[model samples]
Target: MKNKKAVVYVRLKEGVLDPQGVTIQRAILNMGYDVVEGVRSGRFFELELADGNGDLSGKVEEICRKLLANPVIEDFSVEYT
Candidate 1:
C-alpha cells in the first residue's frame, strides 16, 4: 500500500467577520509595523492516508466539508501529495 499525504486549509469566507485576524492586525499596527496591511487567520490540517482508498479526492472533500470546515461560513481547499 502506498502512503498518501493530504493538506487541508480552512479559512473564513470572504466578507465573513474574522475577529482574530482583526485583533492580530491591530496588534501589528500598534507595534509600529506600517508595512502590514492585513491579517487573516485560518486552519491547516495535515492528514496521512493509507493506500487502497477509493475516490481519494471525494473522500478528502467530504472530510473537509463534514469535519474540517463549515460550509456556511468557511471555505476550504484540499491538496494531496
Candidate 2:
C-alpha cells in the first residue's frame, strides 16, 4: 500500500456568524491595510493515509464530517496530494 496525504479545510458555512473573522478584519483595517476586505477563520488538517487505495476519498470525507468539523455550522473540503 502506498502512503498518501490528505488536507482538510473546515470553515463556517454561509449565513453563519464568524466573530473571530470580523475581529481579525477589523484589526487589519486598524493596521492600515484598508485593502483587506474580510477574513474567515477556519481549520486545516493534514492526514497521512497508511493505504492510499482503500476508499481513500470516502475515508477522508468521513473523517472530516465526523471529527474535523461541525456539520451544522461548518463545511469542509478535502484535497489529496
Model 1 residue 15 CA deviation (Å) reads: 0.2
Across residues 33-56, which tens digit of lDDT does each residue of candidate 2 receive? 989897999989999888637657
Give the backbone clash total of model 1. 0
lDDT of 1: 0.89
Prediction-by-prediction clash tally? 0, 0
The collision pairs in model 1 are none
lDDT of each: 0.89, 0.88
Error of 1 at 36 (Å): 0.8
Predicted model with the maximum TM-score: 1
Worst 10 residues of 2 by lDDT: 51-60
What's the lDDT of the predicted structure labeled candidate 2? Answer: 0.88
Model 1 misplacement above 4 A = 1-3
